[model samples]
Target: MCALKTLSLFLVLALFISPKIQTTTFQTIKPKLSILVDNSKSISYFKEEKNLQDFIYELKNNTRVSDKFEIENYIFSSDLQVSDSIDFLGSATNIYKAVTAVNKLNSEKKAPILLLTDGNQTIGNAYEFMSSEQKVYPIIFGDTTTYTDLKITQINTNKYSYLNNKFPVEVLLNYDGIGAVKKTFSIESGGKTIFSKRMQFSKKEGSRIITFDLVASKVGVNYFTGSIEKIKNEKNIKNNTRNFSVEVIDEQARVLLLTDVLHPDIGSLKKAIESNPQRAVTVSKVADFNGNFSEFELVILYQPTNVFKAVFAKIKKAQCNLFIVTGTNTDWALLNAQQLGFNKNFLQETENYGARYHSSFSTFLQKDIGFEQFPPLKDAFGILNFYREHQDIVLQEIRGVETTQPLISFLEQEKQKIAVVFGEGIWRWRAASFLRSGTFQDFDQFIGNAVQYVTAHKNKARLEVNSEHIYASNTVINIAAFFTDTNYKFDNSAALEITLTNKETKKKTTFPFSLRNNSYQIALENLSPGVYNFKVQVLGQSHSKYGSFKITKYQMEAQFTHAAAFKLKQLAVNTGGASFYSDEITRLTQDLLTDETYYSEQKAIVKEQILLEWKWLLLLIISACTAEWFLRKYYGKI
Candidate 1:
């Protein structure tokens, strides 16, 4: 009876007392730490490489700092890599890549970063623009001494020149020293010193611009080397010499202009096309032309008459590019009967129409030639019907109100490029442009671009590969390809493969292109500086294409002879961190440990058993009272 009374009393007290007794726990969250190490070629200039290794080892193994953070390490040059070994063989340095890599890896859990570098960023964005959310402590390395360097800064010349023509070559020479010195600047081509000059540098640190006129004597890829005699004690000699190549082409495009009568438009067109040294223009009347039609690559017809209907047939048979200008004299009946891809319905009248530039024209870029200021062109009042579905409209009509009627348009039919101007009086455009802008450059560019686009060779292959002919060593080679069926529709159902070979090393590497948005593209990285030959082939077909490109050597690491401490310090100041030298790297450990913001954070977890949720205890109390009442009632002591 006493034990039962004791248990009943205990049950009633436990429900109220359990709510007061709660358990608390604390969880310590260690702050994350990221380490970025420079693996560029410049790091090899450090005198004591062991000191750098020891510092890295100490930072990684130090328990006081390591225990407080979850550390991750990475190495970077032009790109980021997660690795422990530092070979210092990377040819470029990009500090921005280091920060971006760390930011991507620790995006969810931000942390402080420890950057070890020489601060000599060569290729990529500036590291000062790194994300501000994470603090960065830079440990700068490399020599801070000043040294003399004389180098060729730039070479300005065209990539292609005509045969036997004199081309201008400009060389920029930069010198850094105290004393004046005499240097010999020379240019060598075809294993001979073609040009040489002696120049004196008197300024402490300045640049000299030297110009030379060299004749393109050979018809091939001419390799030219511009160099300066090396000075004593120069920090870097690799940049003292530079190599550039120019292609000398012997073939010139012949353009035959067929006109019904003498007009200023013929002279204007001739002058514009001849501005390019690679083009020659010949104007002749349709009845006076005696030359073979096959001799010309392009033909411009101005208002063709029925007298020369056979001339049009000869041009079509030769498959030459045509720029047809239509006016009141055009033989519309004969032109329409020949099925020249367009038909006209004349109203027996002429109308004046101003030009409104078309926004969707992408065949060739349009220049700002003030089309609105030019006088309107005279066109036969008509409605033109185009047979082709894909017409590139360059200009629209604004007779009184803007209409969608094409004033100037281009069409591609049966492997022939044909451009049509629905009006006449383009010569006025040139004169008006000169009056407004005081120059005919805009008018000339507008006509020149159109001629260039039409004269360019069109590729009719179902599979096409496109890539730049030249790329820098640090840049990724992105090659894109387009595949089409026999009906000229994009097809991505076939597998594409490419075999890249280094010309110097004769090494072959094969890669498969990944399909993206109905096209095939592949990105190749880490290709050494050299000429590479590539061949692309599509599976299940004999279709293939071959190409070659050059990758210039990356000398960015040699551009800087000293570490950039000011930039590193500025980055540290902006990111709320401290800057230290390599010798003071040990201080970084202590600073991070002492920093209140970098310490481990603790979160308290309190657990309480609420009286309402203690259903077993409540049941026990109810049972105890019931048992007591039952016993009292049974014993007649209620």
Candidate 2:
């Protein structure tokens, strides 16, 4: 009776374990998909590699997540880099090429390709390529409009304005529009419409050009926004509008020109700085500085003697930027006392040599110090050479045999910033060189660059653009901006407005906020990947500044690797994600709806029935108890 009971128990246990073993089988599903693309013509504005990469990512990712299909991506084009292929590695973008690749894919698996393009097929068998696959679905972004766009070719005007004077303005416009229509354009300046005119398009086959002028009533630099009447089929609206900046100077920039003698270099520099009459640059000798030096953006010192030490000391204490020219009579004693000393070898004597008559203009002379006519200093001697390398020197003269060096340098001694020009004799070029190089305008542009560079920090309120970054579709872009104001502290009270405009779509978005530490943040999100322009305007007690921002599409996948499996799934499809081009991932997932295929494709299954083997653990405890009991029963435990 005990033996019969044991057999029956064994049979019952076997039946129970058999069912568990049958249900523990594992399965894997690999979907097959193919990619078809048309790449006959080349896009001049953008790269084709980007389009292909985006399509492949979508195809592989879509197939990876779906249990029903594996992908075989392919491309067709005149120049074939990859044929119809199931492999992840290869390149071909033409339609016929894609069909060839499709034919090579495994037949048993499903086929699909997320095809993408701009629809500019110029070469290859387009008919054959398209006919082979009726399942091609493409996502396009460019080449919707064929009308030639009218764009602002160039804009030239004074950077700053002289109050209540007409500023010379020039603008160039180009387009290929219907000759029948006349376009009227208007310019908005400093919150007011300053100029408007009617212009006709060229009747000829080419582009039309337009030029005009504007007047200003402000003392500071003013930005102008221009627009032309939009046509019925305008290619791009962004091209219809333009921006320019002009400085209106009611009173000219007062320049305190301090010099011991009537040096020709000083004359040249003064001519350059005073080139714009609107800037009130008062050229005063050093003798009068004690009572009159307070009203100048720049203090230009030309070969000043020790007698002028008091004037320089005052300028230094005022914390204003200086452009000091050194010569034989330079106040060495005062310079040493003020810690503005030059190298001992800065001066060297050279023979009187004459340069060959080439009649050339030095790049330095063209800089904005405002000289009307920079005549080259003729054959003169007593040359003083600079020993130190000073990159801050805005422009260097067109040299002969003399090795040119930086005469002006920046000194940061005793926690002060001072600009020093080591020598004189720069004047001889202006009184003489002007007849040769036709480029010598009324003023010296070199001094303009110098003053601008030195006083970059003095301007209390300023604005500038930081970076132009790019991202893919639905991306968040960070636009960095810098704002500084010596008069007003940046805090919650400060207001700034950011305007973003899409050149392609002619869409505008504006955001307003406050700032801190002369800085602010503007986050741009959910934007389509393309080239975008952003304008930042800051309104403060001192001045208003405008800056631009640019954003680009993220095209590379170096950051997306196998480690980012989850993100890869999101890139292609989520249950049903959107894809570009002739890529058909939908067919691959078709089998997912069927019961047999659904059961067969078991990739997400968990293998372990119950994780910890608790029954085995319980058996171990029972075994230990049995051993203990056996020991006590057989060995007579105490």
Candidate 3:
């Protein structure tokens, strides 16, 4: 009984006296190491596949390095992918993208990167200029031995040319380690050599530029191949040839200018519009207008009188683009009756109005021609009342006071584009521009861009599809679409479907567009090199659109012949690291293991607990009290 009572007293006192205690521990965190291996096609040129595999195997098996690091492996070419194996079969190399990917993946915890590559970047930005917080050690894979190689570096030419017109093609040739060698450069089209020339290089390493003029005779896509004859001991033949395509359109856009009387402005406007090679202008008097108006894409009217009302009606009915120049002879009452865009109350007086360029115009890019510097236009003083909203106001009138009254404006109404110039004597502006700058480029560009914008085709359908007309074979094709309600507001509640047909193979592919942030988009991948036609339609609606695009067979990997050692060195220097060759990879490993920055980090962890609330304390107290009660009852002392 005495022992049980004493135990109960001790248990109760221990609970009140106990305090919380804390224990601390320290652990070493292994440093993170990221290894990036180049799997691009260029790595295969130097037979470095086995060497890369051996290097990775040694690193992972080395206890000194493996014990210090938590490793991550990645293989990259044009894209970054996490993998345990490397395959040297990628079509192109994008070193910049690989570095960027590592930086993004380790944004929270910066890890040191070990890169193995030939540093031949055929796509994306240069990796040398990319900044990162982690050190990057680059191990070059290819030999630095110089060899003889003649490569066609670049071919510059227009992608589109008019039929029967001669276009210029410039070829850039690079020669390495060959001195005083005569090489033959040839251009072939339709499997026949059309032009050939012999060029002699005097230096062992240099670049030569060759220019040729070729006629675009056919009205279709013309594929041309430029080649340099292989040398006696040349091993790399892929870079010696390159292929490009030019689309030969049928004819230039024809523009007709109809006027009531001959004016100097007609000649000025014709010269400016025809400055572009893709456009031609013809001027004729309104009374003698007998040409086919249907053939012209755009029709310009200069102060037409009531006699040409039939011509105006025909133009409106045909829905051709119109550019109206209003002057003293303009019949405003008749023009207003047509409800073209605006109505004016003539005061029977004329005044000169200078032009002020509007900064808020969005229809087209405006030129920096200094509209304020140009001469004034002879316009009638009137109260103009606009009936419809204008798309953009290119030029506003500045008559002693700057006013919002538009002098030149573009409008779209009833699916037709109309541009109105409410004055005359624009010839004076062209003359002034030439007098100031000694060139008519600014003035010509201003007029030419405006004319092109108003005459360009406008899509008024509720269903509109947007895509580029040309794509490279390796690129993914993304087609975007938009749906509109009856009032031209965005409506995406309807499902849309597109059917793509390969023109040559007659194979069909159907895909449904997925809704993406108020629009619809679909991605098409691995499309072969050919022309494809697509038709899109909205389900349960009559809205449909059709178009075609072409993909070219071109690979960037075939253009590069040697590795870029200087770039790889620069990347190492920029990140406070060093460069090494493949044979010196061991030195890189030793250096990383010895570097203090890569050492493991130790952190201490502390924890605290209250002993009074422990379950063992409660059980002991219950047992002690029960034993004391039992003893007291047995001894008859309860």
Give each model's whole-structure lDDT.
0.79, 0.49, 0.81
Backbone clashes counted, model 1: 0
Full candidate order by TM-score, most accurate first: 3, 1, 2
* Candidate 2 residue lDDT tens string, 1-638: 33434544554454455433223555676544444544432332334455456545664566334445554444555433355432222112344444445545544444434445444432234322233222333444333434545555545665555666666777776666555566777788656777788776754733544566566665554556677787677644555666655555555566677777775676667776666564445566767655545566667777667777687668767765577776666654455455453443322332222222221221111223322233222221233333332333322243444334333455433333456655556665454445433234422454554555454443334554444332333334555455544432224345677777776787988887445333565666666643456667776454444443333222221111112222223333432333332233355334333424223356555454443354654555455556656756677663
| Residue 246 C-alpha lDDT in model 3 | 77
Deviation (Å) of 632 in candidate 3: 23
CA lDDT, candidate 2, residue 69: 50
- The better candidate by lDDT, 1 or 2, is 1
Give the per-residue lDDT digits (tens) of candidate 1, residues 2-29: 5667887887777667664578999998
Give the top-scoring candidate (TM-score): 3
lDDT of 1 at 358: 70
Q: Is candidate 1 or candidate 3 better by lDDT?
A: 3
All models, RMSD in angstroms: 13.4, 19.7, 13.3
Give one digit per residue, the lDDT tens place, for model 3 in 319-398.
88888888877777778787777888876788777888776564554545778887888766787778787854545555
Reference-based TM-score of each model: 0.56, 0.38, 0.59
